[model samples]
Target chain A: MNKYDKCVQYILNNQNHFYRIAYCYVKNEHDAQDVVQNTIIKALENINSLRSIGAIRTWFYRILVNESVNFINRNMKEIPYEQQSIFDTEYTTGFYQPDDELMQLVLSLPNDMRTIIILHVYEQLTLKECAAIARIPQSTAKTRYYAALRQLRTGMEDCNERK
Target chain B: MNENKDINFDKSRDAYNNMAIPSTLDDKVKEAINMSAGKKHTNNRIIITVASAAAAIVVLFIVSVNTSTAFAATLSDIPVIGNIVKVVTGRSFSEKNDNVTINVDIPQINVDSTSAPDTAHVTAEQVNAVIQKTVDDYMQEQQSVIDDYKKSFLETGGTIDEWNQRTIDLAARYEVKYQDDRYLSLYLYMYMSAFAFTQDNYYYNYDFVTGRELTLKDILGDDYINIANQSIIEQITEQVNSDSNAMYWGYHPAGYSGTDPFEDTDKFTTITDDTSFYLNADGNPVICFPKYSIAPGYMGVREFVIKRS
Candidate 1:
């Protein structure tokens, strides 16, 4: 099959993965879906720019991450006083909150470190591939992965002590 | 090393797997693919036509150069047309490892001065020297920051592995914003990302005709400050009204309580002589405020185009 067909198939197979990854950033159902939709459109439109089929997964993830970050940046401006209170309460009531303690700890990490953990541990991408997706150097990704794991270990110990 | 084995991600992985997939996702993917397929064909046709036209131009130019000595002489005489300045990466330095990443691209601006020599004030050599020195100084400052971060990280009971994992990135790059035979506008940005990201931007605007730096006054005349302030306030008010997420200092939304401490003191007032600005393609002055200057950092850079009245 042609590259376009192959790209379509890849997107079809990985749509759920894309949605979950985007959700990690936007923290809402609608915004996550928007990020995924935009990513799909961008990927399809720039498919010819994809130099090699072997690198499609990282290439697609790079677009998804950028779209997710851009969506967050655009919507990060100030809310009106009343609306800001409601926005705060929505988080307190746990909208899109992860159920598991480990997942919560993973999500609590800084944006860069959390992205590395999710891509490496959850998505099972190699540190190299994660670096490519996040557009960081390989060594940086490896370091971030370890640091995330260290944070998680510390978090788990604290949870155990509290229990 | 054994941390990976100690924590079981099975539950989190299960939660990820169990997350509900949107019901409309399949339809969305199929629709996008179909749309792309249609666009690809039209794009390919346009590319072909443009390529053929370019090819024709190349053939005509080659034939003229080979057959006509006068045409060749004219081409040699006029190396570049108008006030076009060429910017090239003069030097690049990159070092990447587990600890840090540094990538700096020093730009060299070459001005093609085919215009009248009498109108020139600042020579191209002076401009190039100033830019080179500014970039060199910025690189040194950033290098010191990285070194300080490394020192602090190591001193704070951080392991070598952890230190290595938190690789800092330092970069310096330049972009040409607007250019013409009369005026050239560009900026050099220095970025360092360690525990957090910080960027510094330096803007340079030169008027080749006057041979002096271009300023808001030069573009907007004697009443430059008032003109810029009025234009900026109107744009900000319009932006805040249109977008729910758009916010600026001093301007309150409908439900705002007028209680923000920064409302009175840190708000954007009139533009000073030192306000950052660059010319747009249409020659309008675009006043700029860096992140956290007028609005929150998330707003990135706030820019307002001051139309000539």
Candidate 2:
């Protein structure tokens, strides 16, 4: 198959990963679907720019990350200070329980740190690959990953103590 | 507690794997793939790039597929049946620097006047002029916004490297929502993003028979407002009741406190005479609400397809 066909097959095979990652960022069904759709269209349109087939994973992930961030930036709104505090405290106290405590903590990290954790830990990408996708230095990606792990540990400890 | 044991990375992985994948995901993916395949690459493309020494104006024009003779020939080859309206990309402007990227595609509408007499009140020239002006004005506004953002980024302690690392994108494109022999509908959207992001959608509907713009009253008759209002309210209530994430401004789930301290008045009550709408493929009127208009921004743009009984 040509590069376009291969890229399409690759996307088809890994669509679930795309949806899950987008959902992690957007936290909603419709927006996640939109992100995935946009990513596919973008990837196919620029398929010729792919330097090597071996770099497809990192390249595709980079586009996906960019699209997700763009979606968030476009939809970002300022909440009232009172409601902001409520949301922050709710994250730490485990009020919104879509999943387990660890996943909740994972979701609550700041955007960059959360992206690092998802790409490195859940997606099983190397820290180097994560850095490439996020356009950060490898050292920065490592720093963010360790920092995220520390936060998760501290959060889990706080939950245990509360229980 | 052991760090590895406490984190329960396996459980988190399981949760990630077990996240509910929308049932329509497969179909959506196929649709997107097919759409990509169907998209035609712009021919006779020209890119005129102007590089500025300082942070000054950089003009780049990408003219694509503007040959009217070829277009006319293609239209003539196809046997004439009824009035035909074709929307094509007339010109495109694209500029990419370290700090910003702007891509805008200006659409031109072509009416096959040879096949059908110009009986409609609105001419193709008028519609095209309106579209061109709207797009031009929006692009200029966004370009200035980006320029100001770049200025402030440098004025602050932000270094060139930091500014280069961050990039703003502005894009405007059009989509033909629905078209038939008698009616045509187009949707145009402009999206601008830097630190703050904004998207605006514009819709145009035309009737070839009357040669005029299509209004809600024209489609639904005199009772257009009532018909649209009833359909939208019913849809909103059903969505809010069925999905926990679906939230409208004036409605909430059962037994839920609908108080929002940000605004005192209920936001959405009924459709107005100027409410935005487009025709669906089935020629049904689909009412549109801009993001943050009726509900939160996360809802994006809400649409309700009005079914005529």
TM-score per candidate, chains pooled: 0.48, 0.51
Please report, in order, the local distance difference test score of every candidate based on alpha carbons: 0.70, 0.71
Off by over 4 Å in 2: A1-163, B1-83, B116-122, B262-266
lDDT of 2 by residue, A24-128 (tens): 777778778889989988988787667666899999999998899888766544444454564456423532245678888888788898999888778989999
Which window of ten consecutive residues has the lowest lDDT sum in model 1 chain A? A78-87
> For each candidate, what's the DockQ?
0.19, 0.24
What is model 1's DockQ versus the real complex?
0.19
Kindly list the per-residue Cα lDDT of model 2 for residues B205-227, writing each as its tens digit: 76554444578998898998898
Compute the lDDT of residue B82 as modeled in candidate 1: 48
- Residues B62-124 of candidate 1 have per-residue lDDT tens digits of 343344444333433543434445667877899886667889887776654664231121334
